[model samples]
Target: MALSPCGNQSAVPTTFLLLGLPGLWETRLGLCALFLLLYLLTLVSNLLLLAVVWVDTHLHVPMYLLLCALATSETCLSLAVVPQMLVALASLHGTAILSYQGCKAQMLLSGGWACTNCFLLAAMGYDRAVAVSDPLRYTTRMGHHVCICLVVGCWLGGFIVAGGMCGAIFWMSYCPGQNPLNHFFCDIPPLLAAAQGVTAPSEAAVLLLSLLVLGGSVVAIVASYGSILVAVLKVHGGRSWHRAFATCGAHLTVVVLHFGCASFIYLRPKDRYTLERDCLLSITYAVVTPFLNPLVYSLRNREVHTALHKLLVQRRVEG
Candidate 1:
């Protein structure tokens, strides 16, 4: 199959094959069971985290609010990729083909949510910095209205970025090849690789948008964290300094992992699309990061632990 140029597109095949992981057959059952377990755990853990943050009045603070947002993002991020992956694992086709519209929709939502998480992490860092640097005015500065606006802005920015990327990608023409993507979901790099040599303008469009979203988010995150580091160091008390640093450690861990893997995949030029390496990096952000975020944040948070114990006690008393 050959893809025509962007403007001169002919009737190309509508379906595209999704090349499943290489050597997957040897451990299909194990991989399926492992992913199924991770998916289940991710849903349960994130939902529980959201519930704890939402129902507990003591947990109703900016930090918990950020946690709730992260939990929600984790749920959506897993949903964007895991279901399709599970279907492919359960089937012998070994390749999941998606329609053009389906591919576009998946890319839009996934990209949008991923970008939102990037901004959210940066916002969370800023929130922490404010709380640490000016503890007396933390509540007044990060008021409810301001927090709500920040969250809304993160989502809005994500939508704008996603829409632009989707527009660029779909505007490009596809070639008349088997249209096999070597990843579970419709990511930008794999999609671009599949449509390579089709058109120069379309390729350029995708590359530009990818760099813009990835580069812009990374720069914002770095700037936010740079200020956060300065704030942490300015605290006089040793205990205060330790606490401030601890508060940000989890967020920083996730930011680094998410941005690191994403930069590896999206920021590189088109010639660097190595299927195996890309697949590994995709799993880092797509699968591992979502699974790890709740564990890292909730497990380290004493407030969540206390709330969970109270919840369990209340439930037991009711029972």
Candidate 2:
């Protein structure tokens, strides 16, 4: 039982209250509707991408396999954060309560998925690099077993890093009457603020772990893209260079959006944190970027369009 501000012990288990998107109760419903629409679109678009990848035998290569993993990660990330955000927004006071255990689970899932995506993007960059650099050897280099291992490694590394960070953050206890979390979901910065008994060592540990995950992934992506650039420039024909870049440009766009948003939120100092500003930025990574991923990939990739068309045509013929 946690002690309330009035010095009364609460009989119920301790929980954290989320003050969703601070200030704007009048616009909460509108925001809720908008987020719902985006979440639904995210689900549909990612699912369609997954279905296309699954049904098209032509897409059974390394690139689409990595893309399938990314789509899955985006959907899971949104599921972990957005529904609860909508519930919080629907509250009359724009606040929602989460059980202590529930909050921990959310932190783990959301953080884990976010980390997983960074690694997956990095893997995709490498896949593209290999495909462009050595087309004849691409299939052998990125065999099914290799892709499987990469996917498994990304997932494991993400969860392990997130578990460590979450462990460090949850090491401290929160008072029942502490200020509500400024963000909709259970994230690190707001939780750090509301927690008591947070020591310098724990804070330093979390920061170091974050740097390793984000910084290391950024390094991997840059290296992969650098190799891709070298390979593209070495190609003899104009069409070859154009084709290679076309394959990589969409990925670069997503990498920019995701890493930019994530870096802004996680890599910044706690002193620079603001309720309204961080919350809006959080929505970008958690909601908007996921929503944009499928669009960016599908709109730009002719292979995806062709695969989707074939799938639709096959369905009609089967019917």
Candidate maximizing TM-score = 2
Model 1 pairs whose backbones collide: 1-176, 1-177, 2-175, 2-176, 3-174, 3-175, 3-176
Write one digit per residue (lDDT tens) for candidate 1, span 156-259: 98879889888878776565535778887888888877674454566677667777767776677677667766776776678866786677788877778888
List the candidates' TM-scores in order.
Answer: 0.91, 0.94
Clashing pairs in 2: none
lDDT by residue (1-319, candidate 2, tens digit) is 3432434445556688998766777899999999999999999999999999999999998899999999999999999999999999998788899988899999999999999999999999899889888889988999999999999999999999999988988887766543479889899888877765534556777789889888998899889888877887887788977887798989999999999988878876566777888889899999999999999999999999999999999999999
Candidate 1, residue 60: Cα displacement in angstroms equals 1.0
- Give the clash total for candidate 2: 0
Q: What are the Cα lDDT values of the candidates?
A: 0.79, 0.88
Candidate 2: list runs displaced more than 4 Å.
1-12, 177-179
Q: For candidate 2, what is the lDDT?
A: 0.88
Predicted structure with the largest lDDT when compared to the true one: 2
